[model samples]
Target: MLLELHVWGPAFSLPSIDAQCLATMTYFSLVLPKDAWVLVASSDPSVSPTNELPALRSGATWVSRFRNIVDYLRQYSGGEWDLDRDLTGGERADNIAFSSFVESRGQSLVDLSLYVSSQNYWDKTSPAYGAILQWPNQWILPPKIHAQAKLRTEHLGLSSLDLEAIREQKDREHSAAVAAGKIPKTLIRNPRETVSTLLSKTSQQNQFRLEALTAEFFEPLESLLGHQPYFLSPDRPTTLDCLALAYLSLADIPDLPFSWLRDAMRSKAPGLTAYTDRMRRHHLGLEVKVIDALSATSTSSTSSPSLPWQAPERASFATLGKTLYDTLADSTPILKHIRLNNRLREAALAPHSGLSGKESKAVSAYALARKHDLYLSIGSVVVSLAALVGYMAHIGLVGFSLAEQEVPSGTDPDPDADIDAVVDAGQVGDFLSML
Candidate 1:
């Protein structure tokens, strides 16, 4: 039986680079039969039991969430790719601590970069979502999604601080200090109100807070990654690597505001960048040239012209029209016949095709039902199209009659009086009143 991994579709980049999606992709890439597994890019989270993505389907069994899916796959694959298999007791403890720290702290940073940061969220992340969704959903879903992210960020206490508000408070403090004739020696020396200096101080404080949170994960990671390629083991990549690589790869994303995290890792952490690069190559098969091109330092001229990670242009009205055309074609008699014939051929070659008596009759009945369904689908489509066309035509005729009644026969309307001009002249209201 084929395996299906239903994940959030790519919008901004390939394999989604969504933390959970990347982790799932990494794990499956290592162990699962690539030929037998199919990746379905799902826009609807409701399809999953838990209403979240990175869901796995093995035969009839459905598994949701990254941890659950990993556990399920471990048992399903008979422990083939289990990283914990060879770990000592101490190593297991380290693994647990590291994984927890990375999942929590690292994920928060990822969330901040992709959702909380105004530049990253609005310009890069929101548009990425809009590209994947259909009309109305494209318009509606992004704001709702962004609001939810903001709420989550607020829960994290990261969204609570307002830099502008902080600056204003600092200004008030300086003013009060001057009014009381208690100006600090530092203020006297500077004598000027430097917003930049104030902002820098606030920014440094925030940076320190971020570093403290991330150090819980990265400090251990950097120490462990001293000389080795992988995190715990020497050769095999583990779950920790999957988790790390997912966020680390975001360093390459152009115009990412929270790239300080990636910069910190690269500059401070030993072998971390190399480990993620190796993992990217090993699991994703992304070319080194492409990977390097996507890195923070690479210039536009030096970067590759195209990469698989880059999403195609967002679907336009023309694409929607094409989709409607294809949908109509699917219900046409010729396409239906072709599809039915293919199904019949597959049914004939099926395992129980040669079976006699009841089995054979059931197969024949199934094929007959399928043929009927094809015709039924086509008929329904035709009825729908006719109804739609008739309704539109009726609306058109009504609009035309209304226009004729609104305009007098002798009236030579000024060419300069366009719709906007006419509306501005109150002529539109008069015409409506006449109607």
Candidate 2:
């Protein structure tokens, strides 16, 4: 069976907008023959069982996330495709340590550059998302992604780079003025002025801090990769190389409005920059044609037939509604606990698709748990609605029928009498008096 790799569509002239997706793309390009596995720009995470990108599908089994995919493929091919199979035990240990370190530090830097910086996000990142996403998704996905990036990097204390945070701060200032009964003066600023203001807030201290952060993240990798084509191995690429490539490419490749991250890499870590460029030229570089999912099967003469890169799956009406619902669910403050639990459950029940028995059990248990959660949620809503209706009826907020009265001598029941009885039982007189 031909393996399928589903990922976010191409953006910024790269294979994927997401860092992990790009890494997975490079991994497959290195290990699997071109004909063995095809890439699909499914983009929509809803397609994946785990609701994540960089998903790998083999036969009926689906694996998601880059690390899980690596492990699954290792078992699936029985170590034939293991990139680290040649590594010594110590080298394998370094692979795990450095990959984690890269993810921890590199994510914040990427998030800062792409999503936190207002100008960069608006000018470059958002548009990239808009280009790949279709219809309503173009509007929804970009902001959602931006919000997620902001959330991930919230602990870094870099609110000055955040667009939403700046707005919120201004709003708070305005509200404080209003609360104090002082009329706040509104200042009209042009786009250039706005951009300048945002930049101006980045104090010299903040600039130094940013420089320190970037150096801390990149310098070690640069030293490790000195005079070597790849990290940890002089002979061939390994998982560490993939991790480094994923983070470095994202930092170096994009031409953003705020080029601090890219500039730092170029100036401070020339070796790392060269390594990224080399790997990209050799393996990470990919050309993908985005085709409409709806028209993928058309036999038109004008249509181009290809693999690896296709348009994202056009969301159906149901899919759109569900996406909207999930967005609302995420945004709702009350559902925070529920969402957290669901995520924890998924983490515990992570799929191991290479093992049939375990994979089946895990998937089945997850599905069953999700089903029960949905049923419980629906039942709670029904119960709450019933309670609300009952309360309304008791308070005479709504009209309702009462039990029939016995008729004397089997006389014909008067419709008007029934109405009167209902009115009396419903407390119409009291309700009207209150009104």
Candidate 3:
């Protein structure tokens, strides 16, 4: 089972799928049973995308990231997640915030390659790698069916969002409009609150951008499983924890905050509310606030990206991106594959297929040095031993020849003479010859 997540490059950087996540998911997908699910909780550059966690979770199968992942290390036994019984208030909330660091903050936000990744891990498989993205026809989750998540947004009889204040004033305006019998222009406070239209973009360019982000993380995950995500899972093998975790994890992006998913516990997936409650108690929660627009651009290239994005340029994310092509020259191909999980990049790295000029040279240099060192060590040892043996034989023969001369030149020097006879020959030359 493959569960596809839509990925969006960060407002300031490109996202990456690095070796660790790749190796992890690679080991995971490759190792799991054939029927596992893979879900890429997808997102475009907007506050609400159809594949966002709040919507996707409605159909997502229950798999606790904390519990299931820990169980994967069953021998190590991390124990069940601290969900309901303990951890409340700020402490539990803080755990969620910190886990984001454990999940999203450390890796690159976007990937630059797709082809290269697809080709490299194409046929490879592993026992522990539950998902592998190198395969095509990768699975994706359709939009939620008849799903509408609602939150009162009113705190203790007080208005929460500024939109909430506007909604309250609308009632006053509606009353006035009724008295005068005139239709109000701003009758609905927020269309998002009342309308059921999807906030997804219809442009192909936007779609390409979203696919890139989704693929960055998803491909590596798929590679690990050795299959596409099922969008559903029977056991803890493939769970919605990955779905719940992604949005809740990356909610720090101010421009693209996902408070809806943060508050989408019983409010959204009532069955998983306890899980969200567990997530909440574990310091996993989200909040939204305005950030500096200058600090938060989607793509950050010098010009525009190869594709369109809500981010500033390709370079902004590059400031913190570890999976960029330039960074992987010194890294392993697995690292390269994981860093930017685009098919193009992965294809470029394939042996005899995509080998770049510099990478080929680097491989050649490394091989040459290894071979040279081995030969030099073996040759030097053989020559030194051969010279020592030759020198010892020469000294023994020269001494025997002198002793035979001292023995009146009548007897032949025996080739098998004893050690004592050779020593006596030296003595005859030194002392007995005078006698």
Specify the highest-TM-score model's number: 2
How do the residues 327-385 of candidate 1 rate in per-residue lDDT, one tens digit apiece? 46646977757565556645454432345567756776777777777779888879866
Error of 1 at 415 (Å): 67
Let me know the TM-score candidate 2 reaches against the reference structure: 0.75
* Per-prediction TM-score to the true structure, in the order listed: 0.55, 0.75, 0.20
Task: Arrange candidates by lDDT, descending.
Answer: 2, 1, 3
Candidate 3 is scored at a TM of 0.20
**What lDDT score is found at residue 361 in candidate 1?**
60
Whole-model lDDT values for every prediction: 0.61, 0.76, 0.31
Q: Which pairs of residues collide in model 1? A: none
Q: What is the lDDT of residue 385 in candidate 3?
A: 69
lDDT against true structure, model 3: 0.31
Error of 1 at 329 (Å): 34
Worst 10 residues of 1 by lDDT: 303-312
Q: Which ten residues in a row have the lowest lDDT in candidate 2?
A: 286-295
Residue-level lDDT for 225 in candidate 2: 90
RMSD of each: 16.1, 7.9, 29.9
